[model samples]
Target: MSKLRVAVIGCGAISKHRHIPEYAANPHVELVAFCDPVQERAKHYAGQYGAKAYTDYETLLREVKPDAVSVCTPNALHAPVSIAAAKAGAHVLVEKPMAATEEEALAMIEAAKENGVYLMVGHNQRLMPHHMKAKQILNAGALGKVLTFRTSFGHPGPESWSVDGRDSWFFRKDEAIMGAMGDLGVHKSDLIRWLLDDEVADVAGFIGTLDKAGTDVDDNAACVLRMKSGIIGTLVASWTYYQGGDNGTVLWCENGIMKIDTHPDDQIIVELRNGSIERHKVGAIATNEKQTASGVIDAFVESIVTKTPPSISGEEGMRSLKVILAAFESQATGQVVRL
Candidate 1:
């Protein structure tokens, strides 16, 4: 079988940190094209990978004609670029917070369906080992009738992580629909929804400029969610966690609590109701430090070859986006937004 040829769009931190390095390491993949508005960034990646690079996506798409492309661009641009890639006969794997809005997300899905191509969303939290194990235990009734729970995903802000950090496009409302919600919050939202296997029915949230970022978007957000199955919970996401602390997600089920990103060795800690503790020593997928993008990319390739639905599908991406948008709407209206 011919190896899958992949072009990576957006040569920012995400592209460098996860996507580019990942594609380079995948033996079944030939990283042939790199794109960025900045010519130098693209040139750097292309030089490193010995691949072609272009500042224009149209040029990359037309010239490379890759089998797939990873859309690691800004949130607002996700739909248009992904739809274009699909229409050009390439499968697409877009980063999380699939699109800026539910309408755009629906359009992307429609485009993929029309093109007869695979459209997977990059919700890697679902792909993480400990998270998958927790879901398995929850699915097998390890957590009987999950009641209420709460969790968070926060860092110092996008400025620290993105190629530009706070000065990066992520802090711009035009580029990023919501700050922590879209950038980090959506991960936990998707994680919880996937872990519990339920849709968020209603969401009430508060978003504000708790910091001096001076951007129209939020730096911190908190919400209480009601699931379709009546499992209620609270969640918080922030970009001001003091030195990028509190980047963890937790689930409090009826039987016990499962925590992650807290302790190094105790990645998965299961505290049973009967006072018995279960510890699972699971390590994260070996991420190419230069980029954590490969594990998910490899998984996407395997899914395509096997012709199976990904753990995080385009629909799942839409569902997660809905929660965040609903949260934003709830904050604006000062009321619970029903999904």
Candidate 2:
């Protein structure tokens, strides 16, 4: 089979670390184009992979006509770029938070459906090995029923991870939409929702720029969520974690408690109510410090190749985005916003 020609839009941190490298490593994909407003950034990746570079995504889509496009741009550009690629008959793999608003996300989904192309969101958390195992255990009824949980994602801020450092679009309200909520909260929201196999019915939170001076976007967010199944949980996303990153989730089920990515050696720990403790080292969870193959790129490629819907479809992306949107509404109104 001929390799699927893949183009990556936005050559910054995510593109450099996850999308570009993963596409290059996939045997079924060819790095055919790179697009970024910063010509140098696009050219750097294009040169390395022997692909063409473009400052404008529309031009890249028209010229290369890639089979797949990875939309790694900022939150504000996710909808437009993905829609354009879908209209051009290319499968899309957009970064998390899918879009800045509900309307934008729906439009991207419609465009892909109209063009008969796959629209996958880059929600890598569900694809993690440890997470996959937890899901399996839950499915097997080992945990009985999840009652409540706590999931958090925190780091020293995107300045350390983003290619632009302190001046990165992450801190800007216009570009990033929401800071910690969009960057980190959305990931955990998607993860917890998927883990429990339920949708968020309501949410209440306190979201603000507690630290990180001169930035309009929020740096911290703590929200309370109640799922449709009556499973309650707390989610915390913060960029003010000065010491290190924390990406951990604990599920309190009827039979036992499951802790994930909280221990250094064990990726998963299950403590039963009947005095049983199970420890397993499934795999490493990807973090800013320790980057790993996210499995998103490969999954997107496979969906396109097989002519099937992506695992994290645009609709799935929209549902996850809705949770964050509710959190924002909850913060604004100081009430539990129902989804």
Candidate 3:
């Protein structure tokens, strides 16, 4: 079989760190083109990969005609770019917080359906090794009816992660739309939804810019979530962890308490009501610098090659983004927002 041709849009931090390298490493993929508003960025990546580069995405799509494309652009650009790619006859893998609004996300989904192309979202947290184990244990009835849970994701801020550092588009309200809630919170929402296999029924939360001055977007957010299964939980996303970072979850079940990604040494820990303790070392979560091979690029290529649906479909991404958007509304109204 011939290799699948892939192109990457937006040669920003995410593309530089994750998508580009992963795609290059995939045996079934041939990195055909790179696109960025800044021609230099695109040219740099394209030169390194021995591919073509273009400043305009439309030109790249038309000229390259890749089998698949990865939309690594900003949140606001996700819908239009993904829709265009789908219309151009290429499968799409879009970054998280799928689009700026529910309407846009729905439009992307519709475009993919109409074009008969695969549309997957880059919700890599769902592919974490520990998270995968947690889902397995929960599905096996080991958790015994999870009652409540708390999940949090926080770091110093995106400034360090972005290519432009402090002036990155991440802090700009017009470009990003939402800050920590959209950046970190959505990941937790997606993870929780997948782990529990339930939808978030409602959300009430507080979102604000408590730290990191000179930015209009919120640096912190906290939400109270009610799951469809009658389970309640708290989801917190913050950029105020100046000292370090914490990304983990804890589920209180009838039989035991399951701790995921919390401990320093172990990836998963379970403490039973009967005083039994269990610990498992799955692996560390991916960081920008020490990124372990995320299964994303490989999975996308495999799905296209085998003609199967990706695990994290556009519909699933839309569901997760809805929860985050509802949280924003809940904050604005100072009332619970039902999803």
Which prediction has more favorable TM-score, 1 or 2? Answer: 2
How many clashing residue pairs are found in candidate 1? 7
**Ranking of models by TM-score:** 2, 3, 1
Model 2 misplaced regions, further than 4 Å: none
Report the lDDT of model 2 for residue 26: 89
Models sorted by lDDT, best on top: 2, 3, 1
Best by lDDT: 2
Model 1 vs. true fold: TM: 0.94
Which pairs, if any, clash in model 1?
Answer: 17-291, 17-292, 18-291, 18-292, 18-293, 159-165, 159-166
Q: Which runs of model 1 end up more than 4 angstroms from their true locations?
A: 284-294
Report the lDDT of model 1 for residue 1.
81
Q: What local lDDT score does residue 90 receive in model 1, on the 0 to 100 scale?
A: 92
TM-score of every candidate: 0.94, 0.99, 0.98
For 24-90, candidate 3 gives per-residue lDDT tens digits of: 8888988999999988999999999899999899999999999999999888899999999999999
Clashes of 2: 0
Q: Ten consecutive residues with minimal summed lDDT in candidate 3? A: 287-296
lDDT of each: 0.83, 0.93, 0.92
lDDT of 2 by residue, 1-339 (tens): 999999999999998889988988989989999999999999998899899999999999999999999999999999999999999999999999999999999999999999999999999999999999989888989779999999999999999999999999998889899899999999999999899989999999899998899998999999999999999999999999999689999999999999999999999999999998989899888888789999999899889888888989999999999999999999999899999
What TM-score does model 2 achieve against the real structure? 0.99
Candidate 3: TM-score? 0.98
